[model samples]
Target: MAKDISVPFSYTKDGIYYFERRVPRDLQKHYSASKIAYSLRTRSSSVAASRATRAAQQLDEYWYHLRIKGSELPGKHLLRMQQNATKAPGSLLPSEHDDNATVSQSEAVAIYLRLKGQNRPVTFHRAAERACGYVIDVCGDKDLLGYSKADATRFRDAFIERKLTGSSITRIFGTVRSVVNLAASEVGVNITNPFTGVYYDRQSGVIERAPLPADVIKAVQRECMKIDDDLRWLVALISDTGLRLAEAAGLLREDLVVDADIPHVVVREHPWRRLKTCTSARVVPLTGMSL
Candidate 1:
């Protein structure tokens, strides 16, 4: 004996036939099977049945695609239904997934703004906006969340072809990856970040030290002598004491102390301005000169 197979079906009040498997569960709440069948019956019983059946199939396909893409159910079914009714023949409905399914370049920018509102830094948001814009410019009408590996690879190649600096390219790619990860979480979609495996070249670090030859030191000292005596003293204090320029500049008259037993300076806050560093406020021995 053969096993029995049961396929769901819907019927109109006027006795028109339609398939139930095609109708999405989300749509069934607002649009009853009988109502859809009756609406089709007004045209022609046979034609109505076919139309209802096709509509059901379309809904099924849309839901299937959303499932494959790992997207969540849209918040509003009636709005989605209206959009579906107006779509061109063979065109997918926008409500099959979230509004973020196939985002416009402008919409991508809006996503960045939302991230910024959550306390993301301005630089991160700006870079994400730019990367998404570039992706949209290259791949028109394609869902970024559902982009294939080939698409991601091609986009990486395109960026490289533009001859942008490696660091700049890396920053943009990093921003895109972060945005996509965040969007995926928000929409309940699981997508492979395009920038996951991409790497950028790093430039060598070079150190430039100031020259300190004896002849150069003599020339600098001669130049310092041409200035006022007070300025010359400041220069000498910095050179001998290894004090930072700001610390030397912050010294005050009261800070200069002269006692036979302990000849040292006592730096204090001057005119309500504190020293740049705690070390700058300490007393130091006056070995070579008197105050």
Candidate 2:
């Protein structure tokens, strides 16, 4: 005997209906079945019920088809329907819009992830996330994808007032621009790229001064020698080689190359590894002091 499910629809303005279904516990994780249920809740009753019936039928047709093919249906069809309902001509019938009025913020984030994929680096992703958070905090449930140029300008002013550095401001604005661009493309909203004409003051560049003066270096070295011989060697290595503090800290025992004819240190992908450019990867010839 085939199991029966009860789907409920509620009536409201314009004679439209909203739906809910009593799904079987055993099929809770079934992609097609869950998708159908999710669809029914957002679509107009007649359409929702029809799609639900089709999805349920498809579920029984072939297990692999339902699992693999059905997963695509929710993202493509259901999400599209929800997007349409939001921008549908005229106000959606109360029942039609009730459960589908605003796209969930989580949905926006999911779309952002799909847009970013693996194309963006971790730093870019982090910056985008920070911008998204600011948008959500300021706009609440409002759709940031639909924000106007004026809105973006307001955000920029607010960010500046918070005393963020020019570089930091640029990074945050860049993230906002990417999210808005992707959101506009995916959600069919026309949004202005806030960072398009924006400019931040670039402060005078400061040169990185070498670590300590000779007197301070000697004093520190003398202090280190009295405390621990290992620390003394570490201080000597940095003072002699001009390696960055982090690179020195992260150096491993295996990174020490004592057999080279020129006796240079090999920094090829070491624990303390930051090369300014491809040209920075060459060996640094050791002096008698470094040895």
Candidate 3:
């Protein structure tokens, strides 16, 4: 018989439905609240189910952004929803606005940073600044809607004058254009995306770095076997796991699961470290010497 999994994340108390969920054990440290509970404020089972579903989904988003920002709520509505669950759950979305086009270049950069920089690497934030700074310098202080194709062409030419290669210029344009796009989509900024259809030379400054040879891997493994220290384990782990050096180095005992049917390593954010991206957060099954 199929098991009953109905209404998985809700319960009733005194005829009122309440939503609840436990924090994942690994992420417990990141949450000030271990178990989240809020009154869904409905008596009907159907209504409770719908509200609970939204509340549950929002809880996932809250947890996700919490992990992304290392304990900070990504937007005010997320906190508002948490604190006031009696309100409709789907109302937790970021406040909608139609004023993005009017936002100046400098202000747009600030908004972009506010959206992305909470837990990102310092270098990531700095890269955005450098990319946007070049544009602001070339285009002068202007609203995003006011930035013309001529300004974009000038920005491109300025990079050319600096002797920057096509690939580098492409990266800068991509970064700044992403900011414009994000503002347009999120803040209702009226824009045709001035940077669109603008092409540049992308042939130069491309470098190739290939994987190590099999013999080099074999030699490293042999050397790892000869030593019995953490460094040796680090070398062996990196060789076989195909994990980033920092990811492997940051693993705590709690992150390793050896006795499961499939042994795996959990890549997660910690107080001391943040995953490079959400896609970087994953479970890699143990294999070969990694097991």
Q: Which stretches of candidate 1 lie over 4 Å from their true place?
A: 1-109, 118-124, 199-291
Q: Which ten residues in a row have the lowest lDDT in candidate 1?
A: 74-83
Ranking by TM-score: 3, 2, 1
**What's each prediction's TM-score?**
0.36, 0.46, 0.59
**Per-residue lDDT of candidate 2, residues 62-144 (tens digit):** 34443555422222112221333334422212234344333333345446655564545555545555566565444432445
The clash tally of candidate 3 reads 1
Worst 10 contiguous positions by lDDT, candidate 3:
74-83
Best by the lDDT measure: 3
lDDT of residue 46 for candidate 1 = 53
Weakest ten-residue segment in model 2 by summed lDDT? 72-81
Q: How accurate is candidate 2 locally (lDDT)?
A: 0.51
Task: List lDDT for all candidates, in order.
Answer: 0.51, 0.51, 0.69
Model 3: per-residue Cα lDDT over 176-281, one tens digit each: 9887887555555457888776767787656677989999998888888888689988878778789888898899987889899999989898878777777998
Tell me the spans in candidate 2 whose CA falls farther than 4 Å from its real position. 1-127, 139-145, 178-192, 204-211, 229-232, 268-282, 287-291
